[model samples]
Every structure is written in structure tokens, then in C-alpha cells.
Target chain A: MRILVLGAAGMVGRRLIDRLLAEGTIAGQAIDVIDAVDVIAAEIPATGRITIDVKASDVSDPDEITALIDKRPDIIFHLAAIVSGEAEADFEKGYRINQAGMSHLLEAIRAKGGNYRPRLVFTSSIAVFGAPFEEPIGDTFLMAPLTSYGTQKAICELLLNDYSRKGFVDGVGIRLPTIVVRPGKPNKAASSFFSGIIREPLAGQEAILPVADDVRHWVASPSAAIGFLMHAATMDTERLGARRCLTMPGLSVTIAEMIEALRMVAGDEVAGRIRREPDAVIEKIVAGWPRDFAADRALQAGFTADPDFASIIKAHIADEKQRVAQAGA
Target chain B: MRILVLGAAGMVGRRLIDRLLAEGTIAGQAIDVIDAVDVIAAEIPATGRITIDVKASDVSDPDEITALIDKRPDIIFHLAAIVSGEAEADFEKGYRINQAGMSHLLEAIRAKGGNYRPRLVFTSSIAVFGAPFEEPIGDTFLMAPLTSYGTQKAICELLLNDYSRKGFVDGVGIRLPTIVVRPGKPNKAASSFFSGIIREPLAGQEAILPVADDVRHWVASPSAAIGFLMHAATMDTERLGARRCLTMPGLSVTIAEMIEALRMVAGDEVAGRIRREPDAVIEKIVAGWPRDFAADRALQAGFTADPDFASIIKAHIADEKQRVAQAGA
Candidate 1:
């Protein structure tokens, strides 16, 4: 199997590459070649049995997209996108990279013509849903995104379904929840605090809590998100029928609950590192986001989420410990 | 107000043009100019007070679209599209014309810049919603189109909302139901039979009924469709907020109910001209169509529909009589 990962420099992309290297196969087929692409040069990890190529490429460029499509990788993992706050602030850049970039890639694949149907696993986000929900939104709710970033994702989802329906590509879009304890520095996304409050404290650093403790949101672990993408790439798409997109299963938790989980996992000292310095801008942005989802379709299709916030914290700690061990070695 | 109608040669477009001419105004403003465009040469009706320019142009061409945008018409009525059967048979042409064409027009409007936000009234269809509906599909149901035509319209709807939200264009999309008692001859559309059975019989000719009498579908008259377009063009869009597209109000009835209504309108002699010749292909296509819609949003926005199928039959008969009277005069 030949695999290609777009946005291979991002946290999820890098982790996914590591997982792929460790397994040495996807869907029981040995991966002989791997092409990892991003706007910034991606790191090429040493795999004894597999050929790896890491390159810097802009997905919005026609030539770049065409070159990648010409390689005709068996499975394409598209996980590249601008975060919410950045996309909202820079509208043209967001639309160009997120919307036009995805369209260009799809058009390139379609232009390849004769029976070149690749399994495309696209990572969408729960931001596609807005405020004023009926407790927990069902899998079949309307996509009336309140932000430009969400709009772009929703538009890409429509394109994925259309391209898949026409048989140009075998595509599956997984709408991921806010990834909890993202193993990275803080970014521009309003929901970045969802990860920061947990990640920073775990590393013995102070983190800011932007919103109220009672404000709830849907989330999944980084491992679970990676699992969703892997499953989507190999699952029986025939069961998806016309709806090619599915909202992945996630844990719903409030800020207070997350703090409680943090205290349980890392003791009082780590949990005390969180400062309640409220940010009105972040609060207003997060207010429009969906709090919970049913995700029954994804659950029925064999996708799973973290059992609880405590486990999520433990998983992050374990991942950090592994990174430290590798560095020491 | 300068009004532009893209598919000005079609049945509804021509009727809309006629309504516009007779009323001599839109949104209570006196119309100064009308640019009616289509692939074929559009006829320019003599409106003593208004200047009319009818042109032959394909909306899919970027140059042609740019030229239309350069004119900067205040209200743009974009109703151009290939029918469902044609789109299904010719996939490439469907995407090129229906999907890319709409995108080109939107891009052109955006390129005009300088705060040039035209009121773009787009004609969507009920085909955006597929089968296994909840008897009456709600206003916020997910769009899962079964046909390429439906997919194209659904994609356009997403684009419309995005563009409108971005302030590039003031747009409103109305998903018209199957037009019943059509004045013209039968076309290749799967739902053509819905109008054929009623139209041909009213003209004292035999028409085939391809499916079972119990099969229900949503419908509206040509005049009602025109009214929906006019209302959409002038309605205060602030009420729409983020979701710009709406399912227009229409009468939902089974074939048996439709025939009964026809019999009451034009006597049993006209109704008896129907022949039951089951067509498997059309039956399959029609089976996946939405049966009914809960268009409460459109109704609340002051969009009206024909009270019953009998009223729809009467409206068609009245329109035909007016056409004949104009010709005689």
C-alpha cells in the first residue's frame, strides 16, 4: 500500500505517521511507500522497510496538487486546514487555502480520469455546527456554520460527498470534536484553550481558562481522532450510502469536569496551575460552538472515543513520557 | 432597479418576466432596465416604460458571466440549470454548467469588489432532499441529494450561504417543488409525468401515468413559483440570519388526489384521457424523491402557495386562457 498524508507537519499528521510506521501496514496491506506533504517541510522518519518522501507543497496550487494526484497514492489522509480564529480574521487566505485548496485537489483527482478512485479520509470539525441546539445535536442536523472556518469545512464536506457520489473518489469525511490535550503550543483557534488548560498544566506550566467552568463542549483524545481517520480509510464505505460524512463519537465535558479530571490525574499542584483570567473575545467565539452531539452513525460504524477525561489526561501523560524517553535514548 | 434573469427563456423565467413587466416594479421600486439572458435568444417584450435587453449567453463561460456582473444589475435572478434526467445522463456537462457555472458567477460578483453586493435570487429544488424522509421533511433536515442535479443544487446552496455571509452577495435560495400542470410539452425530467398526466389530459390528449397512484410528491404552480422568486428577491434577508436557503411552500398530494382535483376542475372527460403505462426507470427515480416538506420558515417569511391541487389546475387554465387572449388581440 502507498500512503500520502497532507498536512503531515501538524500534530495529528505527525502522530498518524508514527502510528503508521509502528504498524507497518494499513488495512492488512504492507505500506511500501509513504509521501508526506505540507506547506512547511515535513520530517521524514526512518522506517527500515518503507520508502518515505517528505516535501513542502501548497495544496492550493494547481501544479502542486496535480503532481501529488499523479502519484496516485492508495489512501490520501487530508488533515490540512487553517484554525478557526486565523481563518475568521484572514478571510481570503482561509477561503483560498481551505476551500479552493480542497477543490483543486478534488478536481486534480477527477482530471486523472479512468478509474482512479482513491480512498480519501478527510478530517472535518464539530465547528460546522453553531449555537441554539436541542441539547445534543443529532447526526442529521443542518450545517449552518457561524464562522468562516466552519463554512469552509461544511463546503468541503459537500464537495466530498458529491465527488464520492460521482465515483471520482472513494471519500469519507469524519467530523472530529475538539481534540483534548493537543500536544502542542497554543494556537489562534478559540477552542485552543480546550487543550491548553490541560496540556500546559501537565507540563508544570500555568495556563489561562478563557471561559466559565460550566461551559461544555464535545471532545476526543488525539489517539481517538487518529483512530477515526484510520478506520474511515479502511471501513466498508458501502454502508455509508449517500451520506459520506459522519460526526465521530466524542466525550462531552464541562470546564469544571475537565479540571476535576486534571486534579485526579496529576494531583492538586498540576491542577492549580490553571488561572481563571477570562477572555471576552474567546468566550464570545466559543459561545457559538456546539456543546454536544449524538454521533450515533459513527458509533454504529465502529468508531470509539475516550472513556472519560481522566483517561484522556493519562493518555497525554503517557505520550509525553514516551517522547521524553525517546529524547533521552 | 435593474433586474437580470439568467435563464430567461424557460417557462418560469418567461412567466416571471411577464409578471415583472405587468407589475412595472419590484420591491415597490420602479424598474428602469431588464437584462434577460439565456443560452438561446430571449424574446424582449414591449414594455413602453421599461428598457429591456434580451441576450443569448451561456452562464458557464467566465467572460459572459463577467460581462453580466460588469453591468451590475441590482437584482439577479439566477435560474439556469440542466434538467435532472439530462444531468444524470451527462455527468460532466451537469457539473460544468450547474456547479462551475454558479461558482463562476459568484466569483465574478466577488471580483467586482467596491462593495458591489447584488441581490442574487437563486432557484434551488426539492431534489436536494432524498427518500426515507419523516413523512414531512423539516426546514433543517440535512441535504442528501440522490441525483447529480440535486447534488449540484445542494452545493450551490452552500455557496450561496457562504457568499452571503461573507458580504460578497446578498443571496436567497428557494427550493421549488415539482411544478404541476405545466403549460409546455413533456420534457425528459423524471417528474415530467407529474405535469404530463394533468396537462395532456386537460388538452384532450392521453398521457401515461408511470407510477402507482399512492406515490406522493410536493408541487406548486408556475405562478406560485414566480411568486416565490419575486418574494425571495425582495424579502428582508435579515430574518434569514446564517441559513439563506429555504424550502418554498407547496401542496403535497398523491397521484390519486391530483387526478381527483383535475376531475373536479375540468370534468371526467378530461381526466379520463390518462393511461397507466408503468415505467420502471421513472418509478425508481421518482421513488427517491421527497414526498412532503414542512416549509414553516418560508410560510413565516410570507411566501404563499396554491391552497390545493384544484386551485393549481385553475391557475394553469387561467394562464393558458390569458396567453390565447393576448395572441388573439
Candidate 2:
């Protein structure tokens, strides 16, 4: 099976590509060609196992996506988006990239008729839901997004469902919880601190705790996100019916609990690196997010989450070690 | 206050225009100009009270709405749409009109800077909610529409909410229940039979009942829809916060209850003009619609519903008499 990965330069996208290359196959099919694309192509070296065509393609442009879809990749992984803070700050840029990008992609895929229905896995965010949520938000809660970015995701979810219903393409929209222990520097996402607090402290650096200790959030590991995407790509969607989007399973942990998990995994010295400097702006933004979810449908559909926060920390350390070893070699 | 009606030729639009002219003022503000536009221009006579400019404008086009927003109408009523059946048959046409129209309108309004924000009252549909619902679908139920038209409406609802949240526009989206006792012939809507059963029988003609008598539905009258729009236009949206959409209050009744009400209002002779020639296609389509709704939020916000089905029948009779009287004059 051939694959197309949009936003392949991003953390999750790069990891997914590395994982796919390592596996050499998906769902028992020998992977032949993988089109690794993004707004800016990254340094993806030659994997002698399969053909990796790395290129830069603007997903926001209709003609660009039309050309991409012309390649008829068997499975399309669409993970491109403008982060929440950037989208909320620059309205035009946000809609142009996040909203119009999805619209153009779906339209381009549909235009490729003749029953060219490829499995398209889209990464939607839990931001699609707003505040005053039901405890353990069920699979059927309304999407009253609090931010423009969330609204854009919610609209894309609707479009994806409709396009799938019309038989234009086989689609699955996974509403991923904020991925914790995100590698690299902090981005513009409001929830970036969820990762920074854990990632920075592990590197013997002081991390700013944006919210209070009592603040809780739904999160998953980077590996867990990749697992969700893989399952979404191969799962039987006949049971999904018209509702193609599902909230992926995630671990709900409070900031205090995360700190305790950090202490348990890497001792008090690393956990002590976190400073409790509450940011009112970040606190306000975090207040409108869902604390937990009853993602029963996703669990039933064979998606799994990290057992605990400690496992997440261990996994992140292992991933970091692997990256260092690769660089040393 | 200057007013602009996007779909001024349709049944509800025409009635809303007539009601606005009759009232002379909204929220204690006088209407100076009423720009009535639609895909096809209708003969809306000059009432000599307000300036009624009737013209044809395709809402799907961005440039046209940009020009419409240039007028700076204080209150804009956007009830334009591609009906469910047509949207289901032609996917491109549906998204182009319903989804693109709302997007373009919001963009145009946002583009008109200098703090120009107009009150945009949009007509959404109950079709936004799909089947297997809670006994009475609440305001916060997820939008997993079964049809393409519902998908488009649901998407538009998200856009409206986001734009409103961003302070680009002051928008209120009212999810109207099925309008019963409709004064015209049945159209392409799967729920058209709900009105046809009441309307054709009152017109001394037979109407087809395509579903079981026990099948329940949420419904309101023509005047109730107008009331919802007027209230939406004037209602203080400060309390709405980020969620600018609400399910309008409506009476829940089955076909048997409707027929009983008709018999009480117009006698068995008029009600007996009913045929039970069930159409399987329409039955399956209607099965996926919302049967009832709590609509507590809208009620709390001062929106009212018809007291009962008998009142709906009585109102239709009164409206018909008024129409005949106007024609005679």
C-alpha cells in the first residue's frame, strides 16, 4: 500500500513516518511508495527499504492538493493545521491554512472520481468542544468551539463526514487529546505547557507551570497518537455509520498528578525543576477545555491510551535516547 | 434600522418581510430600507412605508455578499438554502450555496472594518441532529447529520459561532423545527409531508401520509418561525457567550395528533382528505430526523412555541382567510 503524509515535517508526522519506515508495511500490506509532504519539506534521508518522495506542497491551495490527489495514494494522513494560538491571533492566516486547507483537500479528493476512495485519516483536536462541558464528555456532546481553530476543526469534521457519506472518500476524523511530552521547543498552542512542563524539566531546565496544580486535562502520548492514526487508517468504518469522527481515548491527569508521576519516573530532582508561576491568560484559555472524556467508542474500536503518566515519561525518555543514539551514529 | 433579507422570495421570507412592514419598528428602531434579495426576484410591492429594494443576487458568490455588506444593514436575515433533497442529489450545489454562502457573508462582514458588526439572524434546521437521539434531544446534542443538507447547515452553524465569538459579527443561529401548516404545496423536503397533510386537506385536496401515524416530530407554525427570527434579531446575545446557536422551541406531536387537531378545527370532512400511500424513500429519510427537543435554553432566552397543534391549524385557517381578503381587496 502507498501512503501520503501531509505535514510530515511536524513532530507527530515525522515520528509516524519513521515508524512506518521501521515497520515496512501497514495492515499486512507491503508499503511500496510513501509521499512525505509538508509546507516545508524536512531532511528525510533515503530509507533503502522503500521509496520516500519528500516534497513541499501547499495544502491550502486547491490546485496543489488536486495535484497531490492525482497521485492516488492508497492512504492519506492529513495532520496539517495552524496551531491554536496562531489561529486565534491571526484570523485570516488561521482560516486560510486550517479551514481552507481541509476544504481544498476534500474537494480535490472528491474530484478524483472513478471510485478512487482512499482511506483518509484526519487529526482533529478536542478543541472542537467548548467549556462548561459534561463531566466525562460522552461521544455525542455538541461542538461549540471556543476558538477559531476549534471552529475550523469542527467544520472540517462535518465536511469529512459528508464527503465520506457521499462515497467520495473513506474518511476517519480522530479528535486527539493534547499530546504530552511533545519533543522540540514549545509551539504557539495554548496547551503547549502540558508538554513543556514535562519535557523541559526532564532536560534539567526550569519549566514554567502556566496553570495551577489542580488544573486537569485530557492527554495522550506521541506513540498513542500514532497508534490512533494507524487504527483509524485500517479500521472497518462500516460500523461508524454517518458519524465518522470519534474522540480518541486519552488519560486525564491533574498537574499535581503529572508532577508526582514525574517524581516517580525520574526522581524529585527533575520534578523540582518545575516552577509554579501561574499565568492568568493561559489559565483562562485552559479553563475552557475539557478535563476528561468518556471516549468509549474509540476504546471499543480498538484504540488504546497510555496506562498512566509514568509510562508516558518513560516512553519519552526512551524516544529521546533513541534520537541521541541515532545522531551519535 | 436598515434591514437586508437574503432569501426574500421564499414563504417564510415573504411572511417575515410582510410582518416587518406591518410592525414598522423592531426593538424601538425604525427600519429605513429593506433590501430584499434572492436567487430570483419576486414581486414585492412598494408598501410606501419603507424602501423595499427587491433584486436577484446569488448568495454563493463572494463578491455579491461583499457588495451587500457594503450597505451596512443593521439587521440581516439570512434564510437562504438549498433544500435537503436537492442537496442530497447534488453535493457541489449544496455546499456552494449553503456552506459557501455563510462563509462568504461572514468574511464580507468581517472585511468591512471600522467596527461594523451587524446582527445576523440565520435560519438553521433540526436536520442538524440525527437519529438515535435521547428521548428529547437537548441543545447540546452532537451534530451528526444523516444528509448532505444537514451537514452543510451544521458547518454553517460552526462558522457563524466562530465569527460571532471573534467579534466579527453578532450572529444568532436558530435551529427551526419543521414548519407545519405550511401555506404552499409540498416541496422536496422529506418532512414536506408533515405540512402537506395539513395544508392540502385544508385546501379541499388529498395529501399523502408517507409514514406511520405514531411517528412523532417537532414542529412549529409560520408565525412562530417569524417570531423566532424577530426575537433572534433583537435578543441580547451577551449571555450566549461563545455558543451563538440554539434549538428553537416547538411542539412535539404525532400524525394522529395532527389529524385529530385538524378534525377538531375544520371538521372530519376536511381532515378525511388524507391518503396513506407511504413512500419508502421518504419514510427512511424522515426516520433519521429529530422527533422531539427540550429547547430549554431558547425558552429561557424568551423564545416561545405554539401552544398546541390545534392552535397551529386555527392559525393556518386565519392566515388563509387573511390572504383571501387581501386578494379580494
Candidate 3:
């Protein structure tokens, strides 16, 4: 079946495109082709008969979004959003891209009516859950977002449910945890340090730890995130019903455990590259995030993840090695 | 303190306007005129230096919302929303007025920036909480809105919390229970029957009960809804912090209790006007709404309601008598 991936240039987006184009099947139907979009022109994965358009376009632009939808892809993976830091720092840009962009896309889909009811898989974030959280946050936790980015995501989730209920489209919003070992250069998100501490050190570079070791966070590897998205795109709607958003399963661990995992994967030498420089601002912000989460509903939905922290580290190491070898010679 | 009341032409809105102007004090605040708006010209509470503006303008228009904000009133009671049934019947109209209208007002407030950060009191609804709910839905219950109107309210609540957290504005969302003993002709709302059977019979008219007697619902009086708005406008936000939206204290009872209260207030002769006409469609929809709710947080914050169902019926009878006398004279 035809598939479209928005935010194709981003780390998770890139990985998802790779996975979908490489013999990915949903509900036993083979994915024939993939069309992807990014802010900058990039290469999209395409096989012999598959059509892949890797175009540069802003999702908030009505014409751009409409043009992408005109292809009438069977599934749309909406991964476009301003990172958390940029959203918090730039209010207008945050609302425009995050809220308006999603609104325009959903409206466009609804406008297509009868013949088109694409399965929409939107990548939301754990930021939807804010401070004073109950321990072991369930899939049904109330969204009391503390940031503009989170607020935008939460609002989109509501819209997805309403649209899905109206039979305008089949939608699923997957609230992913911080993707650890992101395997790339650091971005503008406050939580970028989450991946940086692992990724930078693995690449034989020093990375700063901005918060205390006791700071806990929920996280999943890139592979797991892609799996969550794929499962969401093909899952039985009868199980999800009108509540279309699901918090994907994640491992909740302290920063110290992350360092321990790093040591195991890349030896103590790589782990030694992490430098701690505490900042109360970052610490306070991190404190507001949930340390533990209960994703029982998502887990039961036939989506799986790395069983433990060690497996996540091993997967990252293996993936990074492949990237390293590809770059060499 | 200057107070602005959006949707002032609505039945509950007008009642609140009259009460605020007549009392000259709410939670110890002094006299103020009410700002009103609707399709038709509204008779606001007073006219003086308070500068009451009663205009016919669509609230969703950015320009109109901006003009309303120009006054920079100290307290803004935002009650303008398309009623549930109409909202459900017309999808685009629901999103335009309820969702987009709210966004326009909020964006206007945000645009004011440092110049104006008025206390915004938003009236939400019990529709935000849908079925399979815990017996007593607590403050932390997830928002599983079953209708378009409820989805809009839930979306607005997220924005309210984010804006408040960012210090852009002071905002509070109060999820009000269904207002009982309404003084009006029966409308199309599925929940209209909840009040109709009691309200019509008291007014010496026949009313149809479309659902089973066991169908439970959370309820508050018109006076309590007004109280919630006023309390929300004046309460200290430090306690609420990031969690700004609250489910206001309400009485949870079944239809049987509601009819009994009507019987006790106006005698069985008036109650005899009630007729049962069970509708499976309405019964199924009503079943998805939360029967009982726990508002411990709001109650602890000092917002209250009628102590029992008897008080609610008494208040309705008192209000209905005044209406009949005024119409006769």
C-alpha cells in the first residue's frame, strides 16, 4: 500500500522511512511505495515500481499539504512538529506549525470524504503529561501539558479522536517517550541531552549532562519508536475505538542507569566521556516530567519494545556501527 | 473590579449578569457592569461608567474578539459556545464557533502580552468525561470526550493550562455539571430531557422523558454555575499551579431523584405532567456520560454548590415563580 511520511528528514522520520520501504507489511499487505516530506530536499527510499517523492515543503502551508495529499497515499505518517525548546521559546511559530499545520492537514483529509479514509499515524510526545503526575502514569492519564509544544500535541490528539469518530479518517496518535541514543547530532529540544549523553560518547566525543543523575525519564530506542508507529498505522480500530491516542510503552530509568548501560555497550572509556554540569532550570523542568509510566494498554495492543535498558544499548551500538562503517571508505 | 461576560445573552449568562450587577459583590469584589454579545441585542445588567457593550457579533472573529479585549476588563467570564446538540448536528459550525472561536479569544489575550493579563474564567462541561468512567470521576480522570463540543472544551483546557504556565495570561477552566431546572422551552439537546421533565412540568406543561429512570447524571443549579465562574475568576492560582482546569463540585443523582424533588417542590399534580418515552439512541448516548464526579480539588479551593437535590428544585421553583409573575404583569 502507498505510504507518506511527514518530517522525513528528522532522525526518527528517516529511520521510519527506511523500515517501511524495506519489505514492511501491514495487516499482511506489503507496503508498495513511500512518499516523504522534509523542510529540506532529501532522498526517499523507493523500490522498482514504487513512487517516492522526497519534496521540501512546509506542512502548515495549505497548498503544500494539499499537494502531498493529492497523491492519495493509503497511510499518512504525520511526524512534523517544532521541537520542544523552539516551541517554548517561540510562541507564534509553535502554535502556527504545530496546531495550525495539523488542523490544515486534518481538514484537508476530511474534505477528501468518501473514497479516501487514510490511516493517519501521528507521532505525539510524552510532554503531554506535565507536573504533579501520579506514579506509573497510565495510558489514560489526563493531558495537562506544561509547554506549548505539549499543548499543541494534546490538542491534535483530541482532534484526531473527533475526526476518527466522525468517520472522516482512521487516526492514531502515538505518544512516544524520549528516543534515547538518537544516533545523530543534538537538536534544539531540552531533552536532546537524553540522546546526546549516549550518542556523543559512543562517537568518541564528550557530552554534558545538564541535570542530576537522579533525574528519571521515560525513553525508547529509535527501533522501538518506529515499531510503535507501524503498529499504530495497522492496528484494529475496534480495539482503540474513539480514543485514538495511545502512550507507547517505554523504559523508565534514572540518568545513572543510562550511564551504566553506556558502559556495558561501549566499555567504560566511552562512558567516561559524559560530563556533569548541573543547572537548576533544566533540573526543575525535568522534575515536572513523569519518571515512570504505565503503558499496559499499548503493550497489550501487540506492539513490543526492547525488554530492558541493556537491549536498547546493544541495538544502538549495532546500528551506529553500521552507520560508522558506511561512512568509512 | 470590571467584569466581562461573554455569551451574556444566553439564559444562564443573563441570569449571572443580573446577579452580579444586583449584588454589587462576588467573593468580596465590588460592583461592575457586564459586557454582553449575541446575534440579537442583549439587555445587560447595568449601564454607567462601567461601559457595558451589548453588540451583535460572532465571537470567533479575531477582530471582534480583539475589540472585546480592548476594554481589558479585570474579569472575563467566557461562556460563549454552540450548544451540544447543534454542535453535534453541524460539524463545521461546531469547530468554527466552539474551537476556532475560543482560539481567537485566547490568541487575542496572548497578543495583549504584558499590557493585559485578565483573569479568564472559562465554562467547560461534563461532556469532557465520557463513559466506562469510574463511579466517581476524580480531578485526574482522563478526557475521553464523546462529542464534538466536549472535544473543543478539552482542547481549550490544554491551551488554558499552557498559557497560564507560560505567564501569558491567568486562566482557569471549570467543567460544569449539567445545569438543572432550566427556565425555557425544551430544546434538541439529548440531555435536555434531564431538565425538561422537571422544568416543563413545573411551568404547567407536558414534558417527555426520553431515557430510563436509572440514567444518572452530574448536575448543578444555574446559581452554582454562576458561582463557579465568579470563584474561578477570583481564586489564587498558586494552589492550582500547572493544573488549572477543575471539575466543579456537583450533585450526582439519577432521574428518579430528580422527579421526586420536583414532586416534593410543586406536588404530584405538577409532576403528573411528566411522561416517559424511552429512546434507545438517547439512552445509549446518556449512558456514556459520567454518572458521578468527585471535585475534591475544587471543593478544597472553596467553590461550592447546592447541598442537595431538594435545594436545586427549590431554587428552580423560586426562579420560575418570578418569571411567571413578571410575564403576567
lDDT of 2 by residue, A1-329 (tens): 88999999998999899889999989889999999999998668787879998989888889989988999999999999878888999999999999899999988888889989999999999989998799899998999888888998999899899899989999999999989999989877778899998999999899999899999999999999999999999999999988899999999999999999999999999999999888899899888789999999899888999999999999999999998999999
> If chain B of candidate 2 is superposed on the true chain B, what is its TM-score?
0.97
- What TM-score, over all chains together, does every model reach? 0.98, 0.98, 0.95
How good is the docking of model 3, as DockQ?
0.85
Please, what are the lDDT tens digits per residue for candidate 3 over residues B93-173? 998888888888888888887858888888888888776677688888899999999999898888888888888779999
Note each model's CA RMSD in angstroms: 1.4, 1.4, 2.2
What TM-score would chain A of each candidate receive against the reference chain A?
0.97, 0.97, 0.94
Clashing pairs in 2: B1-B30
> In model 3, where do residues sit more than 4 Å from their true spots?
A24-27, A30-32, A44-49, B25-32, B44-51
**What is model 3's interface RMSD?**
0.8
Off by over 4 Å in 1: none
> Weakest 10 consecutive residues, lDDT, candidate 1 chain A?
A126-135
Error of 2 at A246 (Å): 1.1
User: What local distance difference test score does each model get?
Assistant: 0.89, 0.91, 0.85
TM-score of 1: 0.98
Worst 10 residues of 1 chain B by lDDT: B127-136
Give residue B197's error in model 3 in angstroms: 2.7
Task: Give the winner by DockQ: 1 or 3.
Answer: 3
Candidate 2 vs 3: which has more DockQ: 2
